[model samples]
Target: MLTNDRIVLKILKNNKRRPLSAYDILDKFLRIKRIQPATVYRSLKNLLEQNLVHRINQSNKYIVSSENSHENDVTTIVVCEKCNDYEEINVNKFKMSLAYNILDLKNFDLNDFSVEISSQCKNCKT
Candidate 1:
């Protein structure tokens, strides 16, 4: 891994349970190194392209990809609105079913996909 990769990875690893925006990561890194916003964004872009990180569109944040997940795998992210935590779930069977349904439409090309579900976490419910 490169220097920027290492630094960004460290920040993400430290906050693995929650998704963070680029600015959030940059703020945490500023105390340690004289880093810039572009540097953090570049590192995040690199990590995202490499599939080492996953972007949560709903929250506009990023999280470390799960250990068992691959770039091609179907991923479902469940986000807690109350706690701002997220978890990744594999839905391979559902993916296959959805793909078949889409294929039956007979003109739609299935490329890439991800699902994000938002709800209050268990702790927050209590």
Candidate 2:
């Protein structure tokens, strides 16, 4: 199941910003193999649990997970709603650690590991 999920992740990595929905993936996979949605969902769930993939909230889309810090497991994701362009914000500065500490103090689950801050891109704005 995990290996199959990685196959799905590889597909996702090749197409960033497309934000494929579950049904979309199901339909695609069904054409190649006779797998049920439940099976795919199960695998996806496991992948998510292992932090090998991520789900977009409000949108219900999936994408490959960004590599995180094993030491602190810290990462930040930036998303553009208009274009659906995503970027991984490498938290090199102290501010990221400060915010992480603050958030941990507040006790947010934040399990999915995504930061969906929406704004128009310069191209979109223009």
Q: List lDDT for all candidates, in order.
A: 0.82, 0.68
User: Lowest lDDT 10-mer window, candidate 1?
Assistant: 91-100
Estimate, for each residue in 1-126, the C-alpha lDDT of model 1 and write its tens digit.
349877888889889988889889999989788877899999999988787888999889989888898556777889998888888887674566576586676666656667788998888899
Clashing pairs in 1: none
Score every model by TM-score: 0.84, 0.74
Cα displacement (Å) at residue 72, model 1: 3.2
User: For residues 9-110, what per-residue lDDT tens digits would candidate 2 score against the true structure?
Assistant: 766777766777888777777776788788679878987877777777757888777665443454555667787776655454345656756456566655
lDDT of 2: 0.68
